[model samples]
Target chain A: MFLALVSGNPWLESLARLAIIAVLVPVTVIILTWVERKVIGRLQMRLGPMRVGPYGTLQGVADTIKLLTKEDVRPQTADRWVFELAPFVIVVPVFMAVVAIPFTADLFIQNLTLGVFYFVAVSGLSIVGFVMAGWGSDNKYALLGGVRAAAQLISYEIPLVMAIVAVAMLSQSLNLAVIVGAQEDTPNIAFQSLAFLIFAIAGLAELYRQPFDIPVAESEVVGGPFVEYSGIRWSMFQLGEFVNLVLISILGSLIFLGGWQWPWSVFDESVPVVAQIAMMAVKTAAFILFFMWMRASLPRLRIDQMMSFCWQLLLPFALLQIIINGLVLVYDWPNEILIPLSGAGAAGAVYLTYRAARATGVRYQPGYQTVGSVL
Target chain B: MTYEEVIFYVVAVPTVVGAIGVVTARNVVHSALFLILSLLSVAGIFILLSAEFLAIVQVLIYGGAVTILVLFAMMLTRVRDMPAALDGPQRPFAALAAGAFMVVSIFSMVSTEWPGDTNKINVISIQQIGNDLFTTWAVPFEVASLVLMVALLGAIVLARGEEGE
Candidate 1:
């Protein structure tokens, strides 16, 4: 990093940086997931598979070995190359996202001129992997699920971008760490809460959890896109998902709550590295818990309902939030109008959204009639 | 070779080969996959150029989103309907167009000198672009946003397919 900065050669520096993070990011994701599972297990009042080795420290290692040694299989009718390549599609984009995410002010690896736009933009790549997996698997369920995920991601991405744009408008920055730092210094959640809400909601939708996970609704699609995957190949997809959870948690802390830095400028540079990691981990843990909580709480949406919710409700709300945020940042709005307007907007949006779905909510009771059945 | 030349070759070669594969490959999936390789190589070039933001955006948007959307469409429509992969067919004037494009691009590259010394990439933040977007280029920014709004609506409409009553 020092050499790249001093010598003015970007290529060598980027290569050097990528090599370091390629190992670093994946390692962090693995260890953190083990921790997440342990926490969740305790939350669920279960022993959480603690029999591996000493507080189940080797639980993940044991599971990994089992998955690794498992048999590899392909469906008889499946396309060979694309089936093999599906997991790579998912892995590469997540790896690429690391470039835009920064740990500290000076500790960033890939500093894009476009900043967070790079982060927002590159997110679309994973859809390819999912979609390809479904179609390549030669299974109806997989293909349908992939198509569903594709729609879900693209639709939710609008709100996600809009929410981020609101932040960029307010702070006037696109760098991930810079966004977090701005929040840490200014502490403007009072005004930015709307943006935060929009971001979180949209973000969860993007992650395809709970209400948004229709594509992988086990009962709906029978294991969805990964139905045909097996052995180490399936493990790659699983690992990618775990990495995604970590990345999204890091992002939540980044864009909404302050990332690694604490409020009030409390810490000095003299603090130890583990302490920094611990602080970041605490913030990240809160986010992961929120994610798992949402997963446990919400019921999955039907495809049309999910699609309409995003495009009609979340999209407009996100647009309005960005506009209001832009106005405040550009020419400070009177608190009189600003505060209540945001609250009313959020409440009204939610109420209308819920009401809109009320009639649609009546499900086909297992024996009830489903829509689009060719008699 | 100098460091710049080495970087140039590293980025440029893959991009060119990938571009060739994207066009020449008969299979639509192969074409799409090759397009990803092409875009990824361009992203590598952006990294080489020290435009980290641009490189990441290339990877995220072009690599992540666009590629995924294409795959989605491919999945929804056809999986095994890839007769082109088995039998290559010639496109009308494809050879001539490709030749012309390559010549023109190389000529442009050779003709244009470096954008002043061709080798300084400051690791600036998103703040700089934001400032530029809102201040010096605010008019263009608003106009561009309006254009994006139209594009967004157009995409939604196109995706939905017009079977309006």
Candidate 2:
């Protein structure tokens, strides 16, 4: 059983999974252009791109071919290795999440001992790549974007961690699979509903969509860290950005939604693998659309406003949820009772926090919000 | 060495080289990078030790976050050229002392008896950790929150305040 394998050298097993992910991430990146166009087409009430082959699918491939054939240009004043390496830096964690994601009942790439913890910890790595890309490019806009990104990622990352920890408190473990299994064991949606909600909101921010996309504030920073990049290199950065979005959406599905686990076994036999893959892909696609929808709908939050939301609104709610989760688990409370109670408590906490912030009108800067916004 | 040992040795070579580079690299940025390499190698070693949590945290925290922070500090400060060679007069003696100390420690560890054979039995499940964390290590868990609070303060001070300079 997985229990045994994970109990065994889970670290080694997870490393192997991560290695495979390194290979798969690029392929997934390539396919995502097609997926994005298809989804956006339907969203915009258009048939989407129906040229350059069947369903316009070959469009992404054609684009890739063009990028490959294009010249690799660098600014005369740029950090060469960091410039070239920035794409991989962004792409690396795109795959690291796969290690914790359980596709099938037992098909997690790497079931780390601390899946939730690792997810929280390692997800921040992408910020470095962002900063590196900015500084390495030696462009002012790139530098500003990089700083904003580092601020945004680190600031939002706190709420994200707090949200994940709420789930961990409910599950009483840091493992991602354990969290999912814990959900399955109960009416997971009911008990951890608050945590799930916080996670979704925070996850969206982490993905740099909508309100939190100020880091990539193209209007202000001029395409951010990737301003100076061109041709294939530019394409690599662009491709990686789109892929990271998909990857983050997939992560939301795996963590907040029950990854690849369907309660009703509609397709019980014969085509289990295909069914599972379909379900996962469909769920991931749904979340990806959600990302796009938010991007289209929500206006970007001011840097200070975004910081306040994460620090004031999200973090407190998440911490309180964690406490309530812990109490529920410790007291052996039933879901029917705790579900509404947790929901009320979460809402109450949010209302109180907002009221307090409004009363104070203490405008918080993103850099200052991290520690100062304790409730 | 058997095949497994050989594999471990080969895997460890990068770690060893990187660790040395972390200490001795001329450029601060290069040193920071070498330190990342060393940290990643340590994560690999943790995998070898069957410590998945430790390994992932090693990568997630050290590789991802801390390395970025270091790089951020570098960029914010804008230290392009490294310091001039600052070899001390007693450098060789210090190296010898450190080497001897490491040898003695290794010798003692080799001679000493260990309780659990990490290679033989692996029981590092989330359940097991949960059972113990809430039971015996509960206090430590609470203390970690305080540490994190302090870290928050420290990061703010270092990143923003003039004291950081």
Instruction: Give a tens-digit lDDT track for model 1, residues A220-281.
Output: 99878999998898888877777777777777777767666776667755435565566677
Lowest summed lDDT window (length 10), candidate 2 chain A: A366-375
The fnat score for candidate 2 comes to 0.65
Q: On residues A1-375, what C-alpha lDDT tens digit does candidate 2 reach at each position?
A: 865775588666766676666777767777877777777678778887799898887888888888888887889888777688887777676556556666666776756657767666656777777887888888889988888888788877877777777766666777666666665535355666777667677778777767678878878888888788777778867765776676666666666676666655445653377676776788788888787777666678777777777777777777778777767777888657768877786677667655744665456555433444424
| Per-model i-RMS | 5.6, 5.3
Q: Model 2 Cα displacement at A146 (Å)? A: 2.5
| Reference-based TM-score of each model | 0.81, 0.79
In candidate 2, stretches whose alpha carbon ends up further than 4 angstroms from where it belongs are A1-28, A35-55, A106-122, A172-187, A263-273, A345-375, B81-122, B130-165
Per-candidate clash tally:
12, 0
User: For candidate 2, what is the lDDT?
Assistant: 0.73
